[model samples]
Target: MIFSEEILKWYRENKRQLPWRDTRDPYKVWISEIILQQTRVAQGMPYYQRFVAQYPTVSDMARAREEEVLKLWQGLGYYSRARNMHATAKTVVSKLNGKFPETYEGLLKLKGIGDYTASAIASFCFDELQPVVDGNVYRLLSRYFGIDLAINSTAGIKQFKELAKKVMSTTNIRDYNQGIMEFGAIQCAPRKPYCLHCPLNKSCVALATNRIAELPVKLKKSKVKLKHFNYLVVVDANGQTILEQRKGKGIWQNLYQFPLLETKEEMAAISLGQLKDLGLGDHPSILLYNERPMVHKLSHQHLYTKFWILRTDKVVAKAIPWEKLPDFPVPVLIADFIKRFKF
Candidate 1:
């Protein structure tokens, strides 16, 4: 009770005035929670606001095209989250009549709603006694309890979840959960925490032991796989370009991009012979956009990409005017190119 009281006091005085705060609307909470996952508040705020304005309700989102949703979500990466959110919106509109599930278990069954998100919505909007254990919670609990377990490890996850459940306040369930997470964000930060003035400093185990830097351990990630991507930027004489949609599963599914020619390994440069069958004639001009391949890093793989600009008089069958490029959804890598590359 004392710990919870201290956290709530600090929270009431120091919590940021975010748009999603003080709202019991489940849709708003759901959207905000999803955007904040693996994204910083400052980086995600504009997108959250845009999303709320664009799709004010589940029915609005369900009626929107997936391409439109992806375009709005461009540059934020982790496109799978947007896809799942769209699918869930359609599900809610069709099956649940635009109403979100009220219980943590029920929310968990929805697409893209994991334990953290479910707990967040369940407690914040539904007044359920579910606790959230996100990165902030994990860090704060690890240091305060002086636990040195690797947070990514299975045993560590279980131990911390059990601890969170035990410590979560029952009297002020929503406020307590929100306060603890807010405390972790501002006071018990990952680096350079304000331990000297922290509300829990007197009883914090890591501070007492002088091991704040090492308490929250995390195992090293596996080596990132390397991929060689060759993109063909085909522009006809009429200042039009060709694009193809990414089909099936895997990275960037259902997104638009220039015709790609993936290779097993990186190549120095591509010649006209390489574009032999890709609607290129003998006299077409081929130039490498970058002298060296651009390294675009994703969570699992590093894309060593090279965009080959091919201009020819050959009339492409499905070429679209370059002015219409912004209408289609593209990856951040391609979006950056479009910003710099002038026709």
Candidate 2:
């Protein structure tokens, strides 16, 4: 309730010296916000610098190839973000005439910009008095106010937005928003928060009532379903590995991957005939080189993957362009697998 001056002062003194904070450019802010989503500051920092340095403007990003964009975003998970970012960049370049949409509503209309991102761009760049309610803000607000509402719920989101807007400093919205967010990240952490040293300890409802963890209430997340996949990493004598761009609408749709055989669970063994059944090639004399099950965890899916690195004496007649393995963009997990196996 009474969270204004103290938080702002603390933030002014303790905010992390991030590169993104140095600029008030909406496009740059948008880039940083998107990169920071589902990513840690430590990891996302370098990516931000690389991306900004490469594509200085929205037009630059738009002009870049999808494969090139994905290559830059290689190690970062959530390939969809990269795809959407490209699409949005093109939208800004073509539709908006190379000018970033200044209004929150206009920004929200972009391919990937959501409420939180739009708000961040608006406040940080445009100096609009809109509150940015990210995960950190949500946690801090939920704990400080002792809100019992499930943070994921529509009602909770509405309430938090209203509260955040109320406390947002009208004169210095950018600093205020950044302050609260930094405070939550550094002090009011999700697990084992440093409450003893926190400036808000005296006024914090969670600290006073010993309910810090419990206060940031959230709906029980849906259990991540386990999916079993057997990736056939078939390579020829020239050391070129078989890779295909995923078609249709699903995870990593445009990203490249090896021939995959999906089952309910991990299979004891897979035959060469199975690879042929998937329309890979005929007369497949596949010699299994490596067969280790790698468990890859996604946001909602747990992939129990069995990678079968098979070597072939010669290229299959039906195989398409195996020499261009490095041309296509792939998910980080697949990319990592390739790099490690030297495929």
Winning candidate number (lDDT): 1
- Candidate 1, residue 205: CA error in Å? 0.8
lDDT of 2 at 195: 91
lDDT of 1 at 129: 90
Worst 10 residues of 2 by lDDT: 276-285
Q: Looking at model 2, how many pairs of residues clash?
A: 0
- lDDT of all predictions: 0.89, 0.83
Candidate 2 lDDT, tens digit per residue, 120-213? 8988999887899989999999888788898889999999999999977887888988988898888889999999888888888877888986
Model 2 lDDT on a 0 to 1 scale: 0.83
Ten contiguous residues with the weakest lDDT in model 1: 272-281
TM-score of 2: 0.92
How many residue pairs clash in all the candidates, one count each?
0, 0
